[model samples]
Target: MKPASSSLFALAAAALHAALIALAINGLRAGQHNVPPRRPAQVQVQLLREQPKAAEKSPATPVQPEPLPQRPVHEHKPRTIPKPKPQPREQPAAPAKTPEAPAPTAQPSPDAAPAPARSNNTAPPAPAATAPAAPVKRGVFVDPTYLATETEKWYPRQAKRYGDQGTVLLHVTVSPAGRAEKVELKKGSGYPLLDTAAIDLAKSITYRPATLDGKPVSDSFNLPVTFQLHD
Candidate 1:
């Protein structure tokens, strides 16, 4: 009997030990398992956006310049001139001289009216040369008183004495008033009585004075009056 009784107590102890171990292991497992507080799933967002990558700076544009201003205008003017001068005048000229004329020649006389016969007694001129002009004769004039009273005739006594025709040449110079100025006898008729008779008769005769260009001139005249006893 005693031994069975010991085995039944041992079995009861073992069951009690196993029960404690089981309780301790269950308490340890419960303590190791921790449950955090369950919150709703919350969404979180960043307040500032991340900065965008910086954009590349574009190249800068160039600028253009402006232009200048214009100027203003005005007016023009004219000019002046000069003057001229005057001239002088001229004169005239003189005249020339003239020449003289030559002399004319004489004409021949007619024989129908007979020239009174004469005896010339003047001497002839000398040479062949130019001579002075000839004297001109005067118109009809006479001294009647001298012509009548003093004339005389010739005689045969003189003719007989000379035995030739008697030449009684008387040289009588007359005055400007027609009176005999002087008488000269060149021959005595070869007889003195007849020569004296001839001279005395000639001294009383008168003649018209010789004239040259109408002026009375004094000159000598010689005449021979023949006394012939026969015709």
Candidate 2:
């Protein structure tokens, strides 16, 4: 009996140990099933990078200016004038006249009587008649001897040189005293020297007085003087 009993006891202990291990394995499988199921692990990814933003712009306004000043103006007027004067006129003149003449008178005859004088005494007196004169007597030479001698002496020497010969006639007046009062050349000799010599000779001659009614009186007569040239 004792051996049997010990062997049975050992066997029982070994079976109790196998039973505890099977219980621990079933507890681990149950805890695993109770835990939630795990979502697939999440992964985030970017294709482009992010860019910075730009600034905004506003509008502008316009300005204005001021004005200037001004000036003034003037005016004028007009004038006047005058006029002229007048003049005068003129006139004319006249004419003149003339006068007249007188008449003629008659002459008286010699046989008619003398007319009585008018008291007014306007006529002139008649002249008286006179007597006739006595005739003159011519004179003669008292002495003809002097005539011949004086002529030869008084002959001009110039007349003789030229062979000149001529006769000069003289008018002689005699006084009652038997003297020659005047001697005038009645005719001239062709030669002047002979004529001048004859005039001188006539002045020197003597005469017999003429008798008027038987009384000695003054008288005139012609006388001739001759000049001759000789060799």
Please tell me which predicted candidate would have the highest TM-score against the true structure.
Answer: 2
**Distance from true location, Cα of 30 in model 1, Å:** 99
- Model 1: lDDT equals 0.61
| Clash count (model 1, backbone only) | 0
TM for every model, in the order presented, reads 0.32, 0.38
Q: In model 1, which regions exceed 4 Å deviation?
A: 1-165
- Candidate 1 residue-wise lDDT, 78-150, digit = tens: 5455554555555455455456566666555665576688769868888798787787966324443443333
Residue 62, model 1: lDDT of 57
Which 10 consecutive residues of model 2 have the lowest summed lDDT? 41-50
Report the lDDT tens digits of candidate 2 across residue range 110-221: 8899977769766777777767777655555556677878899999887787788999998888888777889899999888888889888877766778887667888888
How many residue pairs of model 2 clash at the backbone?
Answer: 0
What is each predicted model's overall lDDT from 0 to 1? 0.61, 0.72
